[model samples]
Target: MIIRHFSSLFIAVLVISVGCEKTDRDRFNPLDPLNTTTGGRPQGLQAVAGHERVLLSWADLAIDAVTSYRLRRQDNGGNETIVDLAERPLSATFIDSTVVNGQTYTYRLSVLIQESEGGVIQESPASVPVEVTPGPNICWIADEGLTQILTMTSDIRAVDRQITSIFGAKHLAVDPRNGAAWTTTQFGGADGAVAVRFSSKGVIDRTVTGFTFPASVVVDPRDGAIWIADIGATVGEESSVSRFNQNGGLLFKITGFSEPSGLAVNPNTGACWVADRGNNTLHLIGDDGTILLNINGPGQPTAVSVDPTTGDAWGINVATQQVFKIRSDGTISLSVSGFIQPVRLACSALDGSCWVVDAGGGQVIRLRASTPDGYHIGQQSDFHLSLTDFFVPVDVSIDQISGQVWIVDRGDGSVVKIAANGSIIRRFVGLALPVALTVDAGPR
Candidate 1:
């Protein structure tokens, strides 16, 4: 009986030892780098601001041991969300395109690992949190009749601030980096023609004078230099484009062009594209006032713009009643004929698509360089009526972030906002001859 009892006790001891061994094998080591109680967390996490997106990056743990990752985000309203990677990413970067402007968000990242032997999942402690706040992509409109520059949200909501007494303000440009604006006025200031700069709050910052007829103004997105296409007293004679610092000081002036009626700055390169209507040429002038390339033959190019995404230039030839696109290297890419009068054109910064305002057709047309055979016409609100006396759109601008288009309806004395598909979004009426406008891509 004693022998049997001893054997049973030995067996019980053996069973307990085996169970303890299994528990130790499956248990996580606190000293292990992959341990959830210790290291193995993602480090150096970063968040960058984008138009309507947030870019996140981090230094992940070793790929051999890591199974996936976890991203946690907290919005301003105290709402939290967690995102888990289905599979490990080749790179440690993710783009959150679902964000909106004017909202603040905080983010955290953690490493995920699974034990090979036990098939037990473990999550490392989260990394340090990072915070970022996004935008206020506003639109600045130039009213020739009211002699004012108005600011509004991309959704066509008024910004509650307007720069007054800007007489003959036919064209305007806003610096996205600082929210400052520059415009050309033909009749208000001490000089008959001047390039005026205003602070973000409707206060006149600086007024650069000595221009015969400053037909167009633009701000280089690469550098905050203001450029003015001064079409001198006579067309084609003494016409020049001048560059100025943010403080209204002259940087340099390039002369010897006829009727420099329009100016567009290349966002990548601070260079400017001048449309000389008198000479019927498009001149790509370097930032330092050097003539880079001159492409002849867009018959009387009245207005010009550059697509930030493609670096291509789009111009409207009112004289030829056509719209054309020019490659950055000075070659004519596509020229589409058949318009009563295409007055102004604006290019999408996010895409190479161009929007043209055909005054005679009373239509806003969208052109894509990839598909040269066809164009999309933004449907006006009165499309069903087929009214001949509809609103006459004289100028066009685009919100780079949202891809929405804003048109200046000089005929109806109103401004209209439309989607990229040409459906009317909203309209703001009762303005005095809204001739020109620009959507501010800068952050407020």
Candidate 2:
């Protein structure tokens, strides 16, 4: 009975000892040299371009038992990796070698001490993940009407956001509901591409791989699906149009036109207008991809915009500067002329004016309501970034609330935000070579 009592007491002591044991992992410091002078604060860490390495650094602590710093990385959709710690306070930055491009990587930190800062060692909170990525695969945009002008420049490289795709892209349309941008990549080197949304900042949401190249894109307000004009070739004898859901699911594909270029969705009519530039025609398709009206017109009409107010459609001639009016009967009428290299068009939601981007003349001409319209030159402004400057601009969009205008400079690879006074406020770089800037400011 005495032996049994002794055994019970021994087991209790063993359990107590195991619970009190400390581990090496519980004692390491963060990658940054903790600065107690700043109340043990750390600062000034940077990530270099074109590398997977992240430099972690901090100031040394002023009055605590900080001996070392520990660094760890958290990858939300990938494998977790730990960065080794520094034994002493850092003079330079510590490097983390296990990061990758195009992944959501975040970091956590801790401090190792002599048990004086506290009775035990403790870790710090993790930081919000820093997303590292390379570049976008493709994006779609509306060609704010310039292709109709005979004197228009054929330089596709001016407004092309992808460096690899210089002279082969057209339009840009953004889905304000879904925050996705769709634009047409032209036919030159890589066939054509369409409907690439920015899933995150500077990252494309391309979920499919094997589909043929696409042209223009517009998101359906009814079902949130993306409709694309898949010409497949610039000079093919036949072509088709396709539809994709917001989830990258291939919903539908329809073939009819010889070559499809421009796409416009009418809200009131719930119809999609497609410009058959190859056959010099326009086809109005219902929501279910059924053909409603096939309008034939003058030589190769490129740019088209639907009138929400009247259900009318306007198009630009690739061989001439004439803006044609497309009646429901598919008849064409000349509206304007004397345009220099007119290529793309955007109809405004606020004033209902049509903004034309003439890449050849380096000018953005605005036409207020209807065909046979007069042009109003916007405030010609200089775009400044670092030391360089941009003279001519391509596409433009405005915020309805603040009345601020944003434009993309084909001369420079930058997008600039302009005040109501046409003064440059802020600029964002690294967009390859931006030609168009479209914003989806929600519900306005």
Candidate with top TM-score is 1
Local distance difference test, candidate 1: 0.76
Off by over 4 Å in 2: 1-172, 182-197, 200-206, 235-238, 327-334, 370-392, 397-405, 416-432
Put down candidate 1 lDDT per residue, 1-444, tens digits, no spaces.
999999999999999999977655532543255454445456788786555777788874545656777899999999998988756354688888878875878899887777695688788778888876554566688877887888765545333457777777888888877888888877854567778788877788687888887878888876688888887847334778889987888999888887888889888888889999989888998888788998887788888989887788988877767777888998887777666777888888656777777788887667664646323233332211111233689887887777777788899887787776667866778788888888775653
Q: What is the C-alpha RMSD of each candidate to the true structure, in Å?
A: 17.7, 18.3
Local distance difference test values of all predictions, in order: 0.76, 0.54
What's the CA error at residue 50 for candidate 1, in Å? 18
lDDT string for model 2 (1-444, tens) is: 999999999999988777766321242333333422222223333333223444555445443555555556667665666654655443435666665533445655545555564477644444323433311111233333332101000111112222232344455556656555655554333423344455423355553333355666776765667778877665543477777777667867788677787887775665788888878888888877788987765568777777555666767777876555666566664465545666676555555555555666665555555434332232221221111244456665554344445566666555565544445655544344455555544332
In model 1, which regions exceed 4 Å deviation? 1-135, 235-237, 373-390
